[model samples]
Target: MTVENEIELTAISGRRSTFEGDPRPGDTLPSMKDSPAVEAGSTMTMTPGLEASRDQLQLQENEEHSIEVLPPVDGGRQAWLFLLGATYMEMLIWGLPFSIGILHVYWTNTLFEGEGASAITLAATLQTGLLYMSCAFFGPMFAALPRWTKTLQVAGLVIGSASVIASAFVTKPWHLIVTIGIFYPMSCACYFPCATLLFEWWHASRGFASGMMYAGTGAGGTIFPFLMQGLLQRFGYKAAMVSLGVGYVVTGLVALIPIKRRIPLSRYDQDGISRIRPRIDWAFSKRKALYLGIMVIGMTSLGNFVPSLWLPSYVDDLGLNKPNGVALVAILNAATALGNGLLGWLSDRMSLRSTILISCVGSAAACAFLWGFGKNSGVLVTFAIIFGLLGPSFSAVWSKIIHLVSKDDPAVTALTFSIFAFVRGVGNMSSGPISESLLKYDTMRGVIGAYGYKNYGILLIYTSITILTGGAAGLFFNKIRDV
Candidate 1:
């Protein structure tokens, strides 16, 4: 008999049915709805075989219910709206932090004159680090309490806005750390996890959708630098910070309206008595592929923020006017936006490892060649655009990373993403101290060419090497599949 016929026979023999008609190949199978119901509140007992059959029927029903309830993936009004909301969230959560280069320029010249680069860079680093690190905690929190997502997001919006507003009143550098670094990132931990909701809404086009969402960061970074620069020039940093905070509150509230969970909380708690337990995938922690991927992510992350935090200052060091520096930062951000979308689309079409390899190798080349030797505004601008395009947008590969780490198991994807985020966070946090040490001493001075003799030679070489190592991890992609 054919496989289909065999399955039909097996199913028929497994269940004792009330139907009198002999089942045909194409006939609809008997459903539990046709079976006699246990009276309300009456305990029903059955043989072990019967109990197993009933449990199987219930599981099949639940699976069918889930399919029917989920919105169509990659399209439909609700799905697109959710994407739009997520994009806006990305803008507010990441835009300000990415544009810290402009603030670094302003503060060094005025508020924190004579302060070392490490102190200023620390706040920005903390902001970036917390944004990534918090994912480890918040990812699990959301998984455990999916119903509270909207509430937590709303709270985050308020806290983040307040933190920015508070930064306006800061009189010292540490104040900026508390407001911008600590409070803002704390709020981000709440808001950023909402991006995972897109997984529920889009599957086929998830990479594309995530790319579009992260493009918001690029959008924000592009516009905010210009905006903050203009604001600081005209109204001063105090007014500029306050205005951004107010703007975040107004815009964030509107964006939150469309954001929501795909599946209802009740669906996961069918009996209304089962406690919602956190599903921790400890086995994922033991996988060699996981560690290799983390190392790759960590290495790339070490240099990811170098340009964003220092490029504007580097422009100043080169004697470029403030406007030129601002413009360079804007160009970098615009290129980043393009890169995120393009790489995301590429991941959907090609092997994710290939896309990651391209980003790392290209970024390394830009840093070692274009950025290291850059001497004038023209070279700096070219470096910014190219490096932004190839380097900083590695976050776009996250969806692919999650897919690989989870081995295509949807249930563990979020936790895997969280773990990767934590690893990247550690790398980001360390980059601040690492950059400090690199810039503190100039061993290459007078020994190498003018480019290497330049103060930032150590920083550039370090960035390039780390990025190359990250790219080398791609060699093991085939091994990951074997695992």
Candidate 2:
């Protein structure tokens, strides 16, 4: 017997469904009155990929059910203090990973000098991959054990700091991957739960609050490059790594002190919490807008790290000094901060599709016209700033995209965030190798460096084209049209 407002969409294992403008025949949203009664405190659990979705639709939020009265939402000292801590972590701990380009250069030419670029690049990919991959696993843990939030954050910082300090002793390239690349990101994983916490503290101001946190990364990028450059030049890579690790130990403790939960631990419904694992729930993937959104995320992520991975080397070939490369990276990072704030605010006021379009078209054009033809320090620096603003800032618009896909349904929102994050993680890991392969041969080596032919002609083409395709992918998500 079919319920009046329910829509039953079955998903095949390992297969993705396609949706277009209209619902397929036999689809309807069952009214809440038609649904059967459920016992209080009951929970639903199922296998990961094999589950079917029979959505008990709530198309609008007419009421909220809760046993406890939480703190205020949107504005308060707790909210602002939490943002300050998050922004601080974003600037320092997270900033180091994004600023890896400078160290990447030093590693290739000085530390592991003469080693294959492929092995060195693996360190970058590994850290970035783990940083995102943790979102899928750790996000739910915090939900399951909200009381463990402080412990988890403290533990993650200790592990990440120890990993970085340990990295100073690596004798082989793979050892660097283990310490700095893998373990360090594992520590950063603790940061993911803040999303849930932020939502709790600032319901109305979520978008603006998120933009502020993301902009901190840009701020870190701007400052860290020069700071790191000075350290590495004066103290050597080992000392630089140790100093940074020590800084993390001191700063992280102070920074994390303000990140408090809005809801009391006693109020949470922690039924069967131990059974939770990093979920792979694709039950909601039947939406056409969702699958299309995933494709866009994966495609853009493939190109997102290209500039950071290759810019230092690209400028080295341009006959620029180490400081010039540092300057370019810093400029790029500062622009990224501005881009995050700008793109996020725009997404709130306009269609999310418009923001994606802006990011894609602007980033692709930067790669093509500016990065591809660059032949001097000035041109490369301009490419850095423009691309930084348009490229990574696309990620800042993710919450809006997910909202459109889920129609503000909170259950689907969490799963979709993890799924999109995982895909982007996979894309980021895959880009290092793909880009290395793209560096095939540079015929214009040492020549006037026309059209980036000096060293990265093929790489530039691949980066720009893939980013454009992502924009094309963005056009297919149907939900954003309503916004």
Candidate 3:
């Protein structure tokens, strides 16, 4: 073969050349001894087939990892259904607790052998206090136990069931206090936080969802009282307790079965980190403190629940008797449920602060004008219906607090809830005592005095002041963006 032909053949064959010494001047070709590879930058190129194969592998890995870490989104249908189940469970749990009043009266009569209203009210007060106090640990515990959400829910069902069942067997106040007050709260604490996770799954409907959640408390109040009253009248406290406990356990289990973690376990720690540590926001920044202070005043003064517990007794004093009084309690709860639901929806549509202000003012007016000076049964009934309809408007207060802090700030939200709960707890603790003190005294003229108020008329005046204060504070709460 010719030299040029041989050189062309070598180039086409992709053979390397090497040389023992450096190339001579003007020599472009590399010797056989010197050559082992192609020119610079050539090594970086890949065949099109290999490039496509690598891309396919990367895409498969991405899809696999995504499926492993995240939950499948299904146009939010399954999520909404799960929310429904959660809502039902929340209603049942909260309702059962709120309905303890009738049981309180019956238990006092049957076991304590006491007819004093003050003694019976202590059970409710203690139950509320314990529930609120449990808030302190619930946030932290929930943050740490994201992996075991459903487990905590089941435990809540067990605790709630056992509390009432055990209370039925108690013969003393302490027994009632320990089981109903302490154990029930501890269990609820476990479940309430988990139940709130539904919020993460549904943002657009959160306000409506929250309203429905609270309305369950009202529904519980409505149902429990009537049920307990009837049961006590017929089968008595022990049988009633057994039946209620069984019902709670069954309902709780059913509701809990549908309660699931909307987010996959792998997605919980968002920053590619494993093992989430509990973080508490202790800063109590000026904004948080201002919001918290307003809540405290709202909880203690206007937003307090003194009248809700005592209104039935007041009806009795006004000659409404037991049946009508119980019915009135149902009416109040119905109103509360309706009001809370409506106002919550409105708050989301309009302004949360406005809803709060309007609710507080309406409640105050109802107390002062309708309830305070009602002349007869017709007037009193009118007051009861009106009050029930408007009184629960303030239920939007919680949504307001949540809005006042950003959704991403879980630590702050948890702390805010704790503070809110603690303050509200103090109000609940004092409500019975304060309302009782005012209504307990009877003057020669048949005027009743309570909480240093000389008459029921005066007691209404004081509550009006509180309600007004709450309204004013609520008005001052501007809508904090991005909170």
Candidate 4:
């Protein structure tokens, strides 16, 4: 039978009509003409063609209905509130680690006087590393136990606070590693995965929301270094830790109040399955775009911590003194906050791959030129601001990557984010040791070239090269479409 005849037959049999080809946008289905009325209890037999057409029409309707039910993107009371809560949590969870440079300097000079940069860096590395890694590890937990999100966040806050407080009492660096580095990050992991809720609440503006939320880290980093410095200078490490612990309790309690899932917890329930069994998306894991994106993220992450952890120390090495160093770190973080919001907004409006390319290249330029030959404080400060503006906020791009990989399916997006987090964590976790190894050679201290130069020369060159490579990788993303 002809396609139109089949559709008419389906309609006559009381089933919805389907088109021969895909329906054009705004096109309506053909209507059935009036026919002789049949008896009330009589059933009409449908041909095979009619049955197929009806089934296709029903499937199309169902798909369209599903699209209609998704949450409204951008501006809404609930979306704004969710963003606010997520941002606050981001500040508390990621801020301290970003500002760990101040603590790193303090420990090197006073507490761990005999230790090398590599050993001391391990603490901050572990803390930041675990923070990123936990997102991968605990993401499934958040999805499975949606009802317990608040409880888990509270537990994380308490653990992190206690770990920081306990770290103040330790005399050895390893003790700090265990309490502050390991335990604190474990706590943050519990809170961080809750960020995935943004996927459920946003669509068109997902990149902007992710950027604003991650900007909290920049805000915290900007403010906390000074707060930490003043506290460390006046009250000492022990008092500073206590004050941070108290502050965490107050801020975390307030922030947790508004943070909630947009969808009902029951939606994740798999026939009342236990919350511990994580639902992994193996199909997503097999995607080339996912792995390629991860490679780009991981390579760029190699240099992510280099500036945050070492810039202050590098300033001190330049004989600039403490306040100058703190100012540079603060400037970097301030720029970071601005970059996160701006880049995120740009990603939403422009090409995601292009935005990433710009960010990576700009960061590389800052590292090579501003940082490489920055013998003076003014040059270093400029480098800090420019690099901060370009680097560090790369995490915001994950929102776009999620959209590309999962086609905006919330369940698939969550699992994909976890995998991305895991791969990025591997890069971050290795960065500490890699940075330490780069800084080992003091022989280049007076050399002329960028690579063969003095303190931090090799480190700067390595960072610049890695970031440039990452920018180059953006070209391949054209294969993925919209990335």
Candidate 5:
């Protein structure tokens, strides 16, 4: 039969039903294949060639549920309120590190007598390394924690807060490292899963929500420096640490009460089989997840912690005192938060790639132009502002990943995110050391050039270049279509 004739035949054949009740004279037949037929209360006529059309409609519905594209999900008021809690908690969590530059200087000047800039640099790097690396371990763990996510989040907040507060009373490098790096991140890891789950609930608004939550880091970065400086001036480092830590603990506890996973469902085929596999399917390994991993690793490795870890130190090197240095850090973080919101909004409306590209390029230019030849306080402040605003705007990266990937395939989503975390973790691990080395290079006055290039400034130039390359990666990413 011709295709059209076959379609007609199929439609007619599909309508041949065995009804539970007697059919009325005018009652249209139903398809046995499409579940059992009802009585004369309602009737569905089988139109010619509609077999194909019905199949197409069913498939479209299934795809819509699976793909998470088009109009987005049906999140209600509760979901948005949850997002707000997340935004505040995350801001508190992320902001602490952004303000660490001030702490680093404070530690070097007071707590660690004779501890040079390099030692301080290493400490900040380790803090960053722990924070980023924890995400990789926590991402998958968070995904698997069907229960206990909240428990862990609460525990993390408590520990992080207590640790920070307690650390103020200690006077050793290992003490700070153990408290800030290991303990603090361990607590933060509790929220990672909750954050990703938020995306599942708010798929349509995921980019915007993600940006808001991530922007908390920038906001924290912006506010905490000034706060810390003020507290330090008023009550000394120990008192300030206790106050900040207590605030984090209290904020986290309050915020976490409402942060919860939404409705749950089975991942099963209609044939009554679960999608969960007995073992890892090695076959799926050679796919898009791997490429995404490489991209994340390279991009993150380039300049992940420059703003959070190095910017304040660099500012201090430019002849600024403590408060002024802290102010510079605040500017960068505030700017970053602004960038996150602006760029995130644009990503949903425009091409995500284009937004990220612009962000990366802007960061690069700020680093090279503003920081490279920055002579006076004006130039330094300007560089910090521009860099703070534009540098970490790359927060769009995760949002773009979610947009490109299919949410229905949780395995793929989980794997891709795992890889992203892994790469970014590695980058976070190295960024501190790399940045320190660059600073060291810049400090070796009259070695690289006769003009005595400012090592910190030159390193900032390198960071800018690395960030610019990430932009290139985003642009090139457009070519690979089938993820």
Candidate 6:
């Protein structure tokens, strides 16, 4: 209605309203039908404000369509090439760390000799823990400090390579704890923030991109075990470390070639003052999706290292040769890569709830039936593949979880990803000590993975329960989210 009309109605409202059984605030003073306040016939309408939704409607809108002059996004040759470089970066940076299980085997038996399992496991924990924990450093912080990104990335390259090379000269296992476990991983931690680039380049197919990027770690795991085994066996840890260190530097430099941002940037604005970027989104903390992500990632991660770190030893306990153990780790990693890619794709088609349930429950089942009752090498290898497919693929759902929690807001989604990463990292680090305690229960029996996995029966059960619990969280995510 016109302002004059609205004012006319408001001026008469105080006298009385009787157009019907009740009158709204913005109606013309109603002509009283029962009372004699005014004329009985009233010509007026109500203008109560629209309030169907508690939240104000259309507060924000997607601006991508309006930026007609922007460079290509979501898909292009450059975007695909950047993904390739990122995949290789994932392989090089994460290959050795992911396959630390192999080193855990060699060092405990050959290098460390009398050192306890917990002491040896500390090395793997530090390598993974520090790297995973690094998510807190730069992923969200880069918003306030974009200028330092390239500098930090370069510095990390140098430090990471040097750390690996330094590991070659370690005379005692403790020396490795510093060089390989602590320093090297801290250096590589810088790479975690690079994921923002992938997010910028591929908004629509983020799940697939995340999966492909993560699969690099599994791919590296597949190759590194055999390569490290040969080097450790033939030349020793010193030579192997040196060889990997050299390759780390060279390949990383090559990978940097294709790492480009999709958003167009001018030199003057490179510091990001004018650039629209993701901010640290705190609202996610209040959402169920965020907490559910923590449960899934945390539970899976706590049990994750158990298999990768213990599988080789499990083989040895079964009286299988060392090479067989190495082979199984490779198979597990290979299967993990495939599972990640497949599940990532599936997340695009279905809700993350379904994918998470599929991974956790299926993985828990593998732990129970395949790993639990293994009678021979055939069962062991099968367990590795099935568990790898169902268990480690839990990571594939992380991007989708982030999507749900952030509501596709770029700044908030970035922060959510880091929170999830930090949770998983803590899980990886803590599992080392936890698994050590679980190992003391070698005498227990009759649980899942009881037959051939006698030495790790308790550990196997722990892994299964945690994963199943995480899946239960997934199964109920929808119900909780609705509330």
The alpha-carbon deviation from the true structure for residue 285 of candidate 2, after best TM-score superposition, in angstroms, is 3.5
In model 5, which regions exceed 4 Å deviation?
1-75, 115-123, 265-285, 307-310, 320-323, 403-415, 440-452
lDDT of 5 by residue, 357-416 (tens): 777777778776766666567877777767766667666457566535533234345445
Clashing pairs in 1: none
Candidate 3 per-residue lDDT, tens place, 108-155, comes to: 666677544554556566776767667666765665666565676677
Can you tell me which runs of candidate 3 are displaced by over 4 Å? 1-59, 62-75, 114-121, 265-274, 278-286, 289-297, 300-303, 440-454, 479-483
The digit string of per-residue lDDT tens for model 6 on 145-228 reads: 555556666678778899889977767778877887778876654466557667666655777888888888789889987788
Model 6, CA-based lDDT = 0.69
At residue 360, give the lDDT of candidate 1. Answer: 95
Clashes of each: 0, 4, 16, 2, 5, 3
lDDT of 1: 0.72
Clashes of 2: 4
Candidate 2, residues 399-422: lDDT per residue as tens digits? Answer: 666655654433345556767778
Better of 3 and 4 by lDDT: 4
Q: Write the per-residue lDDT of candidate 1 for residues 1-483, one digit (tens) a residue.
A: 111121221212222111112333344433333122211222223333333455665654553221122344578898899888888888888888877877877777888888755666677778878888988887777767765777888888888899999988877888778888888886765455555666666666777888888888889888887788789999988899899999988999899888875543332233755444444566777777777778889889888877766676677777777447678878888888888888888878878678888899998888888878777777777888888887877878787777666654323666777788888889888877788788878678764432454468888888888888988886677666632
Task: lDDT winner between 3 and 6, please give it.
Answer: 6
* Pairwise TM-score winner, candidates 3 and 6: 6
Model 3's C-alpha root-mean-square deviation from the true structure amounts to 15.6
RMSD of 1: 8.3
Estimate the TM-score for candidate 1.
Answer: 0.80
Tell me the lDDT of model 1 at 78: 81
